[model samples]
Target: MSPDLSLIFVLGLRMAVAAAFVVSASIIAERSGPVIGALVATLPISAGPSYVFLALDHDAAFIAEGALASLPVNAATLFLALTYVLLAQRHGLLLSLVSALAVWFLLAAGLRALDLSLVGGLIANVVAFAICVPLMQRYGHVKMPLITRRWYDIPFRASLVAVLVAAVVTLSGRVGPAITGILALFPVVFTSLMLILHPRIGGPATAAVIANGGWGLMGFGVAIAVLHVAALRFGSAVGLSLALATCVGWNLALWWNGRRKVAVAK
Candidate 1:
């Protein structure tokens, strides 16, 4: 498979734009409140475009096709971030870690049975999710105001929107770029609106962190999409390289931020 330079360039540009929107929106949502930020973060906005990409490539097996085509890694990462917030609101670090690990292993084994070697991706996501749980719990103690009463309705509404939109987009056909762009931009738009509407909430640091994290997640997703395109054009190895690069870049950003916080505290 020869590389399509044109497609690569287009995908890269699309990803950059989408990532910028995610970051901006997340910042706005976080500033509005934890409940709202978590709600927006967990909506799986990246899934629609991802599925559209898979359909474009004509991948038959849903799991493989979807996993490769869409930004599962990115969606899973944000979902994990929101999960950490939810856990911190109700549980301690040890319990949250245990639960996250349990979920990861269970999902990994189940996916493996289906012959998906992408178990590593799932594990990586679980680890990312777990990292935030402890941090949020600790932060909750110092930043009491950050822990808003969980708005159960927000998750329900967000989930409903995510599912409905994803379904509609997936069934719509080869509009991969357009579908993904819309899905990728949804959270940004929602979060930004919320932030503007409710300016007196959450605070600057929380908003920044959430926004940055969202950008990182979106970047991660776009990276996945690039990998899928690469694999289709080149080979599995090339795709794997792109996937690993995304994971490494995201994790590195996480580590860098964590270290910076530690340094500031000292």
Candidate 2:
């Protein structure tokens, strides 16, 4: 293969493979119901694949800086989820998603104006979630109805994620670490959920999934914080493992507890 053709082939392969991974995770999320769905949604479906590609190109320190910037962006996503969950209860899909995206963009844009250190990012997340967690508990659960699957659903969603990931990979270099980090954590899964579910099952049902996702979102913040520390200490490879472990372990514990409660109720 010629060098240029090989580069094109590699890029195409990256897009296809990442898209497949995100689409598969999203399907599992839809099938899993609110609690587990949130768990699955909160996993690093898009971000994880993007990180793998980034790690291939960047050093450990670079990866660590990206993780540092991702901290507050994770909080912004939780706010986006909260905004969508609330608006979806009383609004159409357009209003709900547009409002949520607005919230996300505002937070991301604000990050550019501030000199946000690691501590500042952590504090921002803590304060935001402190207010939202209680609301999530009250409003996040609703009985989910069966979804009618469309032939285009998976393909459509796969394309969106692929495009988003490609943009992140292509742009991460030109953008500084703060912006790159924020872009990496974009809520592609949440956007897909609203697109697929709101029309099929209605707003309240779709909103429940976002609301339920709050805990996992918080866990994601913690995991990224750990990634920042671990990368600086142990290296990016080890940091990624530990960060993934933290998120996975947190969700697993929540899942086990949910099951234990159901068994007791039975």
Instruction: After superposing candidate 2 on the true structure, give the runs of residues whose Cα lies further than 4 Å from its correct spot.
Output: none
Query: What are the per-residue Cα lDDT tens digits for candidate 1 across 1-266?
Result: 34788655655554444444345445444454543443344333344333334444443333234454234334443543444345434555545434544453344334333432344444454565555544444333222144342454344334434443444344435544433432332333333323332233333334333433544555555555655566666654555466556655655665577568889999
Tens digits of per-residue lDDT, candidate 2, 110-216, equal: 86468578888889889889977777777766888888799999999999898887887788789967677878898999999999999999999998888988889
| Candidate 1 ranges beyond 4 A from true positions | 1-45, 48-57, 60-144, 160-171, 174-177, 188-200, 203-206, 214-218, 221-225, 234-249, 260-265
The C-alpha TM-scores of every prediction are 0.37, 0.96
